[model samples]
Each structure stands twice: as structure tokens, then as C-alpha cells.
Target: MTVSENDTRSPLLTVRDLAVDFRTTDGIVHAVEGVDIEVYPGETVAIVGESGSGKSTTAMAVIGLLAKGGTVANGSISFDGRELVGLSENELRKVRGNQIGMVPQDPMSNLNPVAKIGTQIAETLLAHGQATRHNVNEKVVETLTAAGLPDAERRAKQYPHEFSGGMRQRALIAIGLACRPRLLIADEPTSALDVTVQRTILDQIATMTQEIGTSVLLITHDLGLAAERAARVVVMHRGRVVEQGPAQQILNDPQHPYTQALVKAAPSVAAARLQPQVFATERGVADGSDGSGGSDGFAGSDGSGGSATAKPIDNIVEIEGLTKVYPKRGSKEDFYAVKDVSLSIPRGETVAIVGESGSGKTTTARMLLKVIEPTAGVMRFDGQDVAHLKGKELRSFRQKVQPIFQDPYSSLNPMFTIERIIAEPLEFYKRGNSAQRRAKVRELMESVALPNSMLHRYPSELSGGQRQRVAIARALALDPELIVCDEPVSALDVLVQDQILTLLSDLQRERGLSYLFISHDLAVVRLISDYVCVMKDGELVEAASSEEIFTNPRDPYTRRLLASIPGNELKIAS
Candidate 1:
């Protein structure tokens, strides 16, 4: 395809008929095939697709960071009128951080854990000959501030572990844009960040790139984010470019089946959970299930019936002035992680606690799950004071309430097979014998939509979504009445996230379970939660029904959070 007359200028980066393959024990795997994309000077082009769809592979190949045994079998990659396919390691190294900066997906893994932030940033500048030892410190602080880190001097002295997730990501952005590269490739840059933090990080990138006239190649699975951030969109599926066009045009009226499915599956696009008709007609409901009444079995929050109702629900768990504080090292002062926050979870309904990192959402969840004792508060579960529970009483409380951690990869025992992982709970509770435990494991797997064939596989072999399913199955093994889910779907792609939400909703209806769903994605919160609690800096800013909070938010923070949702400006085609 030839460039249009309007965009006739030579592109800063171009990939024509790019094909990438990886040699494995079984055979060669085609990771990318006949993929073509272009990013003109100062333009932002996004590659959107599901996991394993070759989006990241294309980016990695472009920057010559392909894994071992991976090769560019065919096609061309041109950067600034320079061919990169056959470049040697030394040649590619010079082009990598100097000419083409890259902000990887996971900040924790990308940033050197032992190094100070300032040293890492200075190393990038020094390696590229952008600064001298005398001025490296100054340059590091400047870059850190440019990446939106406040108090760069103090922050630079800390390591990656000392910073929050958003801050760590900002540090990486600083490293990526330190030398003012001509092109930047951000691979799922803010996938795990809160919506508000995500907006700020992306905005920082946009401002810096635009100021320097640097082009961007954004690879993400979020269609909404792609539409809002990039001027042009390239949809990839199974290593092929299925469609490419203007961002708004593709989002509002997607041409390909895969693109349409992505738009429909994105919860951020629909705004509300019960309003399936808004984006349903385009390609059915987001879950790809029948749109019958309460298809997921959960009623709307507006009292219609099914999973939710307008009527006041019975309070299954209630807390008064919940507070958690950690002692400061070598000081009398304490760090207040959660301060005087109070909320309630209604029986058979979902109450979501929404906030950014260190905003007390997760702290509150940990307190509820009995993982941590509250500094000062009163918690009543099923009308029983849980703060004083001990011995058998505490054990009884634990069996009635369960927890599904955020990272499925880290939460499950990697060495254990799927069968043992799920059945461990049954064995611990002594609910059944070996035969009965195996049978119960199968039932749990089926409930979460996993096949019995995967029972023997370890967590390492499962996809992110599948691992989360295993976590859910384990959580339900004991038939807990209330479940605490901390950032459950934040790491999943839109399709897998949709499926998990649907499964949670169905399970809630079938078993009348109450959920304390903690998350930063308001879109996901709106989809699954009947009630919403907005938290900030260890305090509850706003609490109301999901509809009221989204439609008529009273708090400024709530309004800002809603506004920051990606693709909020675009109107989805009905």
C-alpha cells in the first residue's frame, strides 16, 4: 500500500511485509506475518490486539530485541531511512536507546532492582554520550521531572522497590526518553496502572514526544486506550494486520471482525454494566454470551432484579473507622496506609473499592481478608465482631470469607499442578477424601469455564487468564459467602477480562455470594459492582450506587477519575 497524498512525507519508521518466526523444539512458530505499519514524524500509531496476537513481537522485532532462536524470516524494517533487519548486535545497540527508545511493559522487571533511580537514568545518558559525568546528575533530575516524578532529587536517591508502581513506570519513561530519541515504542506502558495514573503517564509521554517531534509506536490490548491516545490504529490478530486506519474511524466504526470484537469486548467503551444495548448491536454483548435478561445472572444496580436491585441490601460485612498504620523505621511517627475508612458490603452484591496505588484500597482489602490486623477499627462480619475472633472462631471466619490476589502468577504455587492447587483448600478444610476432592476440583474447574484436561498442567503452562481462572476455582473451593478480589482483572486483556467478569457475575448469582471487589479501573468497577466506594490518600471520597457515581458524581476526585478513562471522548457506534 502506498502512502496517501496528505501523508506523503517519508515516515520516521516503517515495516513492510514484516514476518518474524521463532524456532522451538516442536517446530518454527510464526509470530508475525506480512505485518505493515508506519509512524510518521510526530505521529502516534497504536498496535492493538489480544495477548499472543503478535503485537509485542512486532515491536520487539522492530527494535531487534527478539528472544533467542527468533529471527526475521522475511520483510523489511526501516527506521529513519536505515534498514535494521541485518544489523549486527553492536550496530543495533547504538540505534536502540539513542535513536529508538523503548518503554517496556513491566516496570518492576525492566528497571534494575539494586540500582538507584538516578544511577539508572544517568547510565542511559552516559551510555548514549548524551551527557558527561559532571552533568549527568543534572540531566537525570531533569528527565525524572519531565517524566512527571515530583521531588526528583529525593526520588532519584531511592531504588525501584522504594517507588510505587506508577512512580516506577515514570522512572522507566524517563529512561526511555532521556536521550530524546527520534522514535519511542511503548509496549502496554500503563496496562497495570490505575486509570488516573495511566492518564498522567500517557499525558507526560505525549507532551514530551510532541515537544521533541518524536514519533510513537504504542502496542496495547486496550482498544479504548488506542483510540484515545493514538492518531492512527493498526489492528493485529494472529500475527497479521487485519485493519488500519484513523483511530476515531476504526473505534467508532471498526471494519474488521476482530476489531469489532475488541470494541465490543472493551468495558471502558460501554461506560456502564447493564447498558449492553449501547454496544451490543454492533457485535452482541461484550461477554459474547446470549443477551437474555441478566445473562450473567446478576441484576442491574437499579433494583430491576437478577444480580442487583435498588432496594437496600442486607449488610454482610460492616466496618467503622478502619485504620491501618505501619511503624516508621527509627522514628516515633507512623505511616498511615489506611485512615478512618468505613464501608459495607451487601449480601449477594458487589461493593467495589476504587483508588490508585497507596490510596488504601488494597490495605482495606487486606484488613477485610484478615491478612493484616487493623490499627484501629471495628469490623463486623455477619453481625459478629471479627476483631476479637480467635482460635476456632477465626478459623470459621476465614472459611466464610476468601481472597483472590491480584497477580495470578505470583499467588498460585508454580510447582503444583492445577489439581493439587485447587484441592489443597478442600484438603486443608478436610471437606472431602481424595476421591471427593478430585471430583470437587473438576466441578470448580467447570464452574470457572476451564476444561478437565488442564487438571494435570502446572500454573506455569497456563495463560494469564487461565491462571486467574485457577485462582478463582480455588477461592470457590470452600464455597465462601464473601470474596475479596484485589485488582483481579487489571492484568488481563479485554477479552479475557470480559470472560472473567462474566464468570464472577454468574457465580455470584448461582451461589448468592457477596464480593468486595477492589480495583482502579472504573470501567471494570462499573461493570461488576453494584455499589462503588471512591478512595484517595487513605480516605473514602465518595460512596454511592454505581449508576449514581458514574452519572452524577458529587466529588471532584470521582469526576476526575471518570474523565480520565481512556476513549472517554469517543462515542461508540450503537
Candidate 2:
């Protein structure tokens, strides 16, 4: 795992014994150990690791994005024949977004809300003087189009909030590549997107970088993405490069145990084992039950666990003729996010709601939550019509049904400690006093298998998975009967996801919690749900027991979703 001085020649970007320490109240925290990575010209190299493996710290270090109190105490970073260590903020600013570009993981926060997409991209070009005032607009259009945004000219006028998650991500990349920087650091750029969108964006990135001879430092947890996109893969663990080699070799014939564990931990790999070698989940795909004998889904191969069998349950929540229409603001035409969708979730059950991005899954969940009043339809929770409820009744309703958002990081208050974040709900609900709330927070943390010591840590101190566990603990603090889990584990690693799923299953059994789980990841749904509801284009295409859906799918769209999963009997090299 050690790279000596002999390994430094002809490297576009070189790191020698990089170390990062965060100054905290608990004293200096060693965030990154002595780490080293190399990115050569025209090379697409990936830094792959689980949450808290220090993959991101190294990426941030390479680009000088490490914030205040985070010091790179050791190591020298040489990029493009220049020493990057000890550069002033202003000096680094000149290099960043010009010679070295970054595609941050979360586009929602990365993009400026007030700026138009075109202007944001144009600013990058303007910063580097790549385009004059008059030419910047044209260059922006061309760049946006290259990033795979259709009708770049018209789309350019839109603000960051107007674009969908995938499109917003493209805009971020467009901004990053507006000047065609020599090195592009993509940090989990495809994680927020669906499989199709992920492939398209990755392809666009790969093609654009290759065409311009730009090297890429791809930081991601998705091993499949690393395999498909990166030429060389560097497996990182706890701020160290445990393994580095060709993608095919590292992925198929992984030498490091951690790398092998990551590959084996893929939910898609579990999907590969299903009969017909397809994945079946709540992702609006017909439970891959075509009788193809491709037998395998989340059914754990080792026999310790497997995909959940879909079974009938007593009704807990039901939506009849659900419809949500959004006014086009300046226009009279309305956007129908959910259309005539009917679904039912039984007590102590999980019903997966699957769809591509912008398929109205979130809108549907919101309608059920009554966060946004439904344009039409009847939502019944615990056998009461909730659609028409308002005021205090709605507040009471929300207490009984809570949600776990897709990004647990943002859902949590960054300024508050984990204890306070979880305690906020308990305080608001007037469930207990300060001491009682603290006790409840600890209990909730224990339920999620989080370390009690983390109770005092802030969001900035915890890893993605740990932060997600905090979110779950906070959700459970309300002691709700039905929890709407929206892509809860989509932002996490496979191993973390497995642990979360196991925790959720254990919670359901122990607490008898009913869950309306919504996600595009079918394998995860199969692992947890008792029933499945497949949605496509704002409509429910099919609904059945988990076993019935997987064994006897009646919808073609459902079947296609199953087929789209990347793994099947194909034994990856390692």
C-alpha cells in the first residue's frame, strides 16, 4: 500500500504522505492518515471506499477544498508541474474551477440559487478568461450541450432550482468543465441519479474528458461505476490507498480484502443472483417473477439472510385516487406529479414505491405527509381520511407519520450535536424534559446501532452512514407507526446499506413499525419489504405481495426495471 519516492515521475497530480487533522473540541481528530494518490494525464482514476474511509478527504485535499480547522499537516501535493502545498486561498482560488475543476457530490448545495445556469457556467469561463463578455453566452450554450443538456440555449436561462436533480448535476459539471480544466474531480456525481441518468452522465464525463485529454479523479463508493468508468482504481480505506491497479484487475481480482468486501457488498451483486439474474424491488418494476428460473434477488447466498418475501398484511395506510397537480406558476396549465394512483400498505409492513427520477414518488409521499396539500384524492392512515385534514389535526397526523428524507446529511441541522438533533423532535412533541429527552436520544441511537459517544458529535463530524443513522434515530424518536423512507440508503455504501436494512428489519420486528419505503433501488426493497408497489410516470402499474410480485410480475415496465440492474450470473474478474 506504500508508494515510495520512486513512483513520482510523469504524474499529473502526486500526493506524498498526505495527512489531514480536524481541530475539534475533543482535540485534534485524525481525519486522513498519511495517504498517497496519483492521477496522470488523460487518465480516469477512481478513489473508491466506503463512508468514513477518507476517500473524500483526499479528494478535498487534492483540490484545496478542505475548510477551516482542517489542516493538511503532512504531505506534498504536486499538480501540473507546480507545488500545491501551502498555497494561499487566493492562489488556490485561481487554480480551482480553472486548472482543477470539482464536481461536488451534492448539486443541490453546490449550485447558486440566484444565478441562471448559463451565468454560473459563464462565471467559470469568465474567471479563467476563456471567453469574452460577448462570447461567454455562446460558450455557455456549447458547454451545456456537451454536458448532455438538451436545448442548451433555453435551458441556460433557468435557475438551479428549476432543473431536476440529474439536470442540476449536469449543470454543475458544465460549470466545472466550462473552462475545460486539466483535472476534473467528480465526487459521487452519479450517486444521486438513477441507473439510466447515472450511465448517461458518466458517459458524458468520460467522453468529454477523453476528448479534451483531461484527467479525472473520480471519488465514488459505487464499485460498479468505478469498474465501468475508471481505467485505474485506487481502493481507499481510513485515508490510505489499500489497493490500486487497473479497473478490471482491482474490481475482478481485488487484492485488498476491503476492496473485495466493497465489490461483494454491492446491492447489484445481490441482484445478480436472482432467477433470470435480475433484480426485483419496490422500484415500480414487476417483481422479476417471469419463471425464468434466474432465481436470486436479495436472497442472501450465504443463507444468513435473503430478500424479504412479499406477503399480505392487515391494511395500515391506503391512498385512493391520489392526485397532485402543481400550477405552472405564471400559466394555467398544471403539472400532474401524481395521477390517479392507488396504493395500500399493511400494518407492520413495507411497500416500496419505485420510479425514475422526477417520477412523482416524492410528491406522492408529500401528499401522504400532507406537507403539500394534495390537489385531489383520499389518503387514509389508520383508517381515517387524512387528505381533508388541516390545522391541528394535520399536525397530529404528521406526528403519527414521519419521513426519512433521501439526504440525511441535509435533513440534520449541521450546527446541532447529534443529541440535540434527535432531541428537537422530542422537545417539540413535548414528550419529555431535558433529561428524559437525552435518555430517549441515547435509546434511539442504540436502536440504530450508533455509538453512544457520537451523541455529542455534530453532522460535520460524522460519516454519511452515521449521519443517516442519526436521521433514523431522530425519525424513531417520534415513535410513529408509519415511517415514509425516501431513498434512505441510496446515498450510502453497500455494506452500510446492508447494515441499515438489517437495522430497519430488526426495528420493524421489535417495534412493529409500518413503512412506506420509496426508492429506485430494487434490491434494497426486496431485502426489506413485505409488499411491493411499482409506479411508472406518476401511476401505479402493479401492486402485490413481495413474493407474488417477484414470482409473477404482470407488468412489462416492472420486468424491464429488473433487467436493467447491472449484475447477473456474470462473475466479475475478482
By TM-score, who's the top model here?
A: 1
Over the stretch 1-574, how does candidate 2's per-residue lDDT look in tens digits? 1223456558889888999999988899888887877887887888988877888888898878887789898988999879998999899999998899889998989898998999888888988899999888999999999999999999999998889988999998888888889999999998878766776787788888878888999998877767667778888887778998877777678887788888767665244221121223432223435443212222101111123554322467877788888779899898888898877775776777887877788888888887888878888888889977878887788788988998878999999999999999889879978888888888898899888999888999998888888998998998999999999998788788877777887888789888889988776777777666777788777666566656566688777666554343335653
Candidate 1 stretches greater than 4 Å from native: 1-5, 274-312
Residue-by-residue lDDT tens digits, candidate 1, 136-234: 999898999999999998999999999998999999999999989999999999998888889999999999998888899999998888888888999
Best by lDDT: 1
Q: All candidates' lDDT scores?
A: 0.86, 0.78
Question: Cα miss at 72, model 1 (Å)?
Answer: 0.5
Q: What value does the lDDT take at residue 131 in candidate 2?
A: 94
Give residue 482's lDDT in candidate 1 (0 to 100): 97
Give per-residue lDDT, candidate 2, residue 192: 77
